[model samples]
Target: MTRSPATPLPPPKARRRLRETAALTQTQLATRVGVTPGIVRAWESGRTTPRGRKREAYARLLKTLAEEEAARQAKQKQQEQQEQQEQQEHQKPDEKQESAPAPVPKLEPESKPEPQSDAKPAPEPEPEPRPESAPVALTPAQAFDALYAFSAPALVRQTFLLTGRREQARESVERAFQAAWERWPEVARDRDPVGWVRATAYEYALSPWQRFRPRHRHPEPPPADPGDRTLLNTLLRLPPRHRRTLVLYDGVGLDLPETAAETEASTPATANRLLHAREAVAGRLPALADPQVLHRRLTELASNERLRAAEPPAVRRGGERRARLRTRAAIAFTVALIGTTALTARTAPTHYEPPVSPGQAVRGVPHRVAPGALSDEELELRQKLRDQMQDGPERLLPRLE
Candidate 1:
């Protein structure tokens, strides 16, 4: 069997983003990836993609470079800040001397206060001995119930931000919860079930199936408070991965590593995405560029009732049945296809030969016969030719005598 030709990898943005996130110049990336700078440019331009192991090497190297670059930047920033602090201290000797700690005043000779006889202070109530019984471990069902109640709204909100559609957000969140419910036995023991659910919901929200779904009859987006609309618009405008990372990082309050886990990306990549996302948001809302200012804004965005997964699921408790049906249908279809193909092959012939009529020449073939073989017309013509040849010599000789 002939193999299908290998197609190029997807999304020119992937290689470009990696290169940018790695903080590598084109020439540097080329040298590191063992390609010419022109080839790297072509990869970024979508004119070509690295094939086979080179593609894997490219991805691995980019991640490695990004981590290294992040470390370098952190070290550099720390050194610069330390040097600046030292310079400021050295430059301000007079100010430092002038700002010396004030001297403590000597205590006055001790004078004891007299107790008031009329006002007896009420005895402080003895602290109740807290019950020391180890807290009861919750059953998985109870744990899931609590998790679902507490995290569902925020999960739905983050998912809505990622997907930009409330209906899809609700669906994704519901699916995530349903999956959690099925796996509750194990998830109850998880360190962060809420994170697990939120991450799962994000994945569901980004499902490719969502792209093919009908968009008609969407519930209208409630009017956003104009105060937050600018941030909302900026978030929505970002690429899905970046937008999802931002929501998980700032909006969901996950730190870089936690956000990376949620986004199924490395910490460095998540940080890079978060940086770009913050910059995009800061471009629109300059106040958010500062860490203090952005923290306050993100706090408001995180708790904004408007961002709450306010809408309840349209339906619940049906996914399992639907999943089973889909599974069975897929198996049946595969079996049927295989059976039909096998049966047809068994019934087919190895080769084909169609009947031909006499005197009809094959399309591209000339008719030929053995020399001894002749038709009646050919025989009669040959005999006449022989008789003429035999009579010719005697008739001519008599005429001459």
Candidate 2:
């Protein structure tokens, strides 16, 4: 049996509470419902009211989360009760001993009680040993905050270098962090969570579909730094692979193998790309012709104040993710069609027999006609006709009888 979907109530507080209970970051919730995090944040803050399917989906997801949270809370309460009961069971013997009456001292005829001093006191209870406490789990907020604090700035800078667009750089970093916020528990446990964020930001910044996007208008700065501008322009103009490879190797200081893993290419392929990239840059800029000079210049550019991020912007990316998918599918279909046509043409038999010329009809002497003997029936008919011509018609009629 199918369960009815939950209808989201119109109250903003109600939705916010549902999201809190579900432990979904606004970004995660937005992603689940196909909206921007800013939109989700607005909805939660009562700044906007989603309508139509958005409203319906918002309600349904919240209701489902509320149900799940209720179930989880109920389960936790049951577990706590069971744990208390077990503790009580373990303490039963001691509790029973403590509750029992102290053994009575029997008095004998010759027995004499010792003389009581000025101080007479009843027996006191011995203190019980303390039990060890369980370790506490870190709250989601603390985990997420810590990760964002340590990683976001670096991700923004790295992405800015990769994309050369300040707004796009910020978008990429935020998107990466949003993903991290959603899976914080696992991220917190990771060996290099920062590395994961960095790689994600790189991929986001280097998204192929970003090419067709309209450029962001930047307010003119006081004056451009010649070296930084030149370097950025050079990096931006190189093919994406070469540019990204150089940044990862020279900018981020990732080793060849690390660069390969992050870029999703083989070590040898990364090596080749980096090598060619260095040559490409050298060809363009005489100052970067030497390897040592190139590294120093790259490091200086990475350290520039212009490369640092100011604050995370409230924008969204990944419109390009779907567009890229469509482009790849279209390109693949076209390639397949071309390949099939080429293969067919290569292997198929040719049908081009040159047309015979009009005057060539007399060619080959028109293959001489050969005479042949007539059939026996024709011969007999001829002989009968000849006899008919010699003899009278009455003689031929009598023979028929």
| Model 2 steric clash pairs | 8-59
Native-to-model Cα distance after best TM-score fit, residue 248 in candidate 1, in Å: 2.2
Q: What are the lDDT figures for the candidates, one per model?
A: 0.69, 0.72
Q: Give all candidate RMSDs, comma-separated.
A: 14.4, 20.2
- The parts of candidate 2 lying over 4 Å away from their true place are 1-137, 216-223, 290-292, 307-401
**Candidate 1 segments whose C-alpha is farther than 4 A from its true place:** 1-140, 182-186, 216-219, 302-316, 338-342, 350-401
Residue 293 error, candidate 2, Å: 3.5
Question: Could you tell me how far off, in angstroms, the CA of residue 76 lies in candidate 2 after the best superposition?
Answer: 51
Best candidate (score: TM-score)? 1
Error of 2 at 90 (Å): 64
- Model 2 residue 19 CA deviation in Å: 42
> Which candidate comes out best when scored by lDDT?
2
TM-score of 1: 0.51
